[model samples]
Structures are given as structure tokens and as C-alpha cells.
Target: MITEKCVRDSFAEQAGYCKILGSSFMSDLLTGLGKQLDKSTETGRRVLQWSGDPAHKADALALRLAGALHALARSGQDQALAKFYHNPELSSDAEFIPAVLSAIAANDDELYQWLEFAPQTNEVARASIIYSGLSVIAKRFGLPLSLYEMGCSGGLNLQCAQFGYQFKGVEFGDNASILQLSPDWSGELPPDANVEILSRQGCDLNPLSVMDADDAAKLVAYLWPDQPLRIARVEAAIAIAKNDPPKLEKADAAAWVEDRFQADGAKGNVRVLYDTIAWNYFPDPVKDRIDQHMHEVGSAANADNPIAWLTFEFDEEDKGPFLKLRTWPGGGQAEILASADPHVNKIHWLQEN
Candidate 1:
């Protein structure tokens, strides 16, 4: 977990205005601004414009504007920022932050609705890395999976394999027909295997019902502020949901995992996995409980009835995502598969001893 001291240190590295505000001050200010911007009243604009420094004022205004767009996107308001985006004068002035807000605001739909604005606390890149790692493990385990994702905001990464992947000299998916491919990779790719996903289920603390168009827009806005691919992915997921919405449940991860594991049909040659980012959000006790349950179930697993865990998570010492692969019925320590950037689509296989 990133410590408060680390957070403070990060704030200390900021320049000029941000530096002056300090971490605590900035935290309060952001929270206050987020609340105030939702009102969309004169007071909001006045507060937004009150920063003393010119740069700070611009930053504050941008933040306020982004926050409002974020709220609109979260609430599923369709194209709420369209007018703002189309206004030629504000286009360049809005910068990347506003551009993201404007794009999301324009894409209000069921699939888009699942996207939620996560604070910086949410580690998207890490999550992507974990997904990539798990994909590799899935291949190695030679298991046909029925994936169940927790906190599956927008289900973008869920489509990782379906989407074209290109990294290093290797390539996967149908890429030549689509966009140019470029991803970072530094190890051997996972062994080729016929992998099939029988089903995909997801749970979230707050599931986006998409009953409200406004909520869909808000989801798009919550996506990373600058990744257009992410926007496209969310849009695609939305389309998928329109045809067949993912089976989603509003529930706690620990309880959900316990119940699922306890249920008779949950066992298969299926590989149960979670990756880099989501695990951190789980409280320690929840994590412990999940781990214990996995271990108990794993103890009974075998080659014919195999259960495996594939995780791509932070390697604090290496400052990158590390892949850990473990199997059950011969319960033991997990093997380190590889370590690399989590967002890179390609997987690098490490030699197992």
C-alpha cells in the first residue's frame, strides 16, 4: 500500500502553486471543489476563479470544469459536455483534461455507464498488467476459463484477448485489420494454447445499472483522463453490454468469493485469478479470507481437476508488475513467472526451474 508519507513526498515534488498548497490542503481543496462544481451555480464559478495565481486559477477552473463533466458523465447525462466541446473557443483551451471529460460526456450509454471515475488511488496501469499476466498464466495452465471479475469497471481489460495485442516481436489478435500495434514487452511470450472463456461475471461495490442515461455519461468521464484507447474500449464494452450485459452483482468481494468457492459448481479445471490493482482495494481481512479459501480449495485440486492462481502484482523492489503462478493439489509457494510493465499487452514467460 502507498503510505501517507509517500503521498506527502509526492506532493513535495510538485512545483510552485501546487507545492504551496501542500498535500493536506490540496486534498481538502479537491474535495471541496468536487462538491462545489456539482452545483453549477455562479458561486461554483466564482470559487473556481478565486485562485490567486494565474496558473492556479486556470488549473482550478479546469478542475472545476472537469469535475462538473465528471459528475455529468457519472450520472449518465448524454453529451452534457458536447456544447462545451463544440464551442470552438474552448477546444484547445480545455487541454487534455477537458478533452477527456468532453469525450466521455458525449458517450452516455449502458456500457459506458459502467465506467466510474476512480481517484488516483485507483491503479489502472497496474490492473492492466495483472490482466496481461493472468492471460499468460491461463495459456500456460491450458485451462478454459469462466472468468469472474470483481470491480470490473467498464470491462475494458476483459476484452484484452479479443482486442488486438502487439508487443516486442510477437503479435496476437486480429491487429493488421485494425489499428497499428505497439506495446512494451521484455520477456518470452506465454505458450500458445486454445483458451476459451465460457462465461464472464463481474461484481462491484457500486454496479452501474445504466437505467439512467446520465449515469452512463458519468462512467465514461471517470475513465483515465487522457487515454483515447480506453475511451474506445469503454465504448466497445458499452456496445457489448447493449447486446448482452455482463452478469453483474452488487456485493463485497470476500463474501462473493467465499460463496462462489463454496458453491458446488464453482470448481472446474478453471483458473481463478485476480491481478495487479484490485487486490489492494480489498481490506486486509477480506484478502486474508479470500486467500485462505483459495488455499483450502486448492488443496484438493489435481491435474485432472486443476485449480490455478495467476497474479500480476506490484514488485516493490523491482518497481514493476511481477507475475506469480501457482497450482493446487500439490499446494506450494507461487513461482515468479516474470516482471514487466502491467499495461503492456504481450506477456513474457520466465523459465521455471
Candidate 2:
């Protein structure tokens, strides 16, 4: 039996020395691990410890095999990869880490092969925060929003604006916004405010069409394992899409925003906003183009017909994550209101100096 203490120590060991795996790869590994909890025994615990050792040349390979084990456990399938995992000679092999990293980087059939072992769950917590944040922004802007999300995988976050939110101490359920915003405020909740979502649309370079169940599952599998709420949120979003799908377009973010900004309906009683956690993936030129387009649109905008750019992303200074608010007509500096969690959950409002 693998005691909880053993598991914790194992995870700590893995977490401390696995920086060489790169953040994105580590995220994927953690997510895979989350799904494999049931099948993770004492042997698996020892394997995780072995995988975390910085001095071990085969750590990366062990991690890869562990991820494979998790994927298998999630899929409700037999552990066919157990032989590869249990090989003693493979543990000390110098080439193991590099090989595993190469496989993940390639995103080849091996990645999918490992993914087949995991079960999907709801991971809506981050989306809930986004909905909450949007609600606050809409109130501040004095307009209903027609949200346009970039890099929306399966359009799950889009539905947060359409669904309901039920937190521990607070209860507010109407039309959900991009993030669900209702915490049990013991004192007083923000004034009985509401933002009409004129429309909800999203674009993804590699959009996961929810019409296909397998694609939907893959999207869920891609989510972080620590975020179980996201899994539920995704499942709910999938259900909503099946009933009445949101309008999703397949296009590049810069091109999509530029074209949409130039379109007629882009100027309406709605605020057009793009929120993404995808800055690292985009090139500098693409980022520049997006900024230019938003600036152009903002210059032409008015209080009567306002346009806003609201973003929750990471920057160099703050390092973690922050929310930026920019508006039209009064085109000034973007205000960093809160220092937020990368996962979009805990937000510490920054005090102005």
C-alpha cells in the first residue's frame, strides 16, 4: 500500500527536480497523473520518486512511463505498458530522458497512445474565474458584452457565460458569463448587476469541435489534472454544446480579430473582448498586429459605442498572472487591477500606489 505520505514525498521529489522537463511538458505529465490515481500503487509511488531524482539520467523516461500508466488507468484499460515500466535496466539508461522528451515534443502517436489510458473529468474552476472577472468588467464598462475568446479549446469557457454558478457561500445563477462570479460574500455582494451577452463566439487555430465526442475527450485530457473542477465544467460545456452549440470559428487569432474589428456588427451595444492564456505560443509579429488592431478599433470607438480589451495573461514583471483592462475613446494605459493565479482562481487585487 502506498501511504499518502509516500505519495506526497514522491510528488515533492518529482516536482523539485523535474524543471528540465519544461513547464508545458510538466503540466501535461501532472494532468496525466491526476487521472491515474486509482491504479497508482506503492510500486507506482516508488516509480514517481525515481522519476523525480535530478541525478538520475532515466528520470525523464520514468516520468514518461508514469504518464503512460496514468493514461492507461484513466482509460479503464489493462496496464499493457507495465513491462516497459518495470524494466530495471531502463532506469539507469542515459538516453531515456531525451527520448521521452523528443516523443512528447513530436506529439506523435506515442502521445496519443499514452493518452488513451485516462478518463476525462470536469475542470471548470478557471473558466468560473473568467466568468466572474468578465461580470465585474461588464459592470465597470457600463455595457453588455458579446464575448469573443481566442484559443478556446472546445469552447468550454464560452459556456461559463451561459451556465450558472454555485459557490460555497454565495448563490448567483442567471445567464453565466465567461467566468462564474459569485462567492459567498458575508458582507454585501456587488450591486445587483447584470451584463447581457449579446453573443458568444470563439476562435482557435486548432479548434476542438465539440460535435465529435472523441475530440471533446481529448480536449478534457489536455486540461491540468489538479483542476478537477475544470473537468466538470468541460463536461457541462460539452453537454451544452450538444444541446445548442456556440458559434466557433477556425482561424488565426490576429487575422480573426483584424477581420472582425473591420466588420459591421463588431460595432454595436456589445463590448468585444479577447481573453487567452496563449501568449507564449504566438509570435511577436502576431502579437504586434493584434495590439495595432485593438488600438485602431479603440481610437474609432466612443462612450456611446465603446470597445474594450480585457486580458488575463502573464508578463515579465509580475511573473505569475495579471488582468489588464483597456478601453476606447479614453485610450490610455492598460490598468493592472489584480495579481491572479495562472489557473485563474485566486485573484489578489493590486492596490494602486
lDDT of 2 by residue, 1-353 (tens): 44444444444455444444333334334334433433234443444343233222323333444455434434544333322233423433544334433433333444434422322222445554465556655766677787788767567667665666654445544544333444332222322347677887888777777898656756565443434455556666687777667788988889988877752344456566757566655789988998888888778777667776767778856485666767776773687655556654555545242
State TM-scores per candidate. 0.64, 0.64
Indicate the residue-level lDDT of 121 in model 2.
27
| lDDT on C-alpha atoms for all candidate structures | 0.50, 0.56
Runs of candidate 1 with Cα error greater than 4 angstroms are 1-67, 70-139, 174-182, 209-212, 224-226, 263-268, 315-319, 342-353
Once fitted onto the true fold, the runs of candidate 2 whose alpha carbons sit more than 4 angstroms away are: 1-123, 166-168, 173-192, 223-227, 263-268, 350-353
What shift in Å separates residue 10 of candidate 1 from its native position after superposition? Answer: 12
Worst 10 residues of 2 by lDDT: 51-60
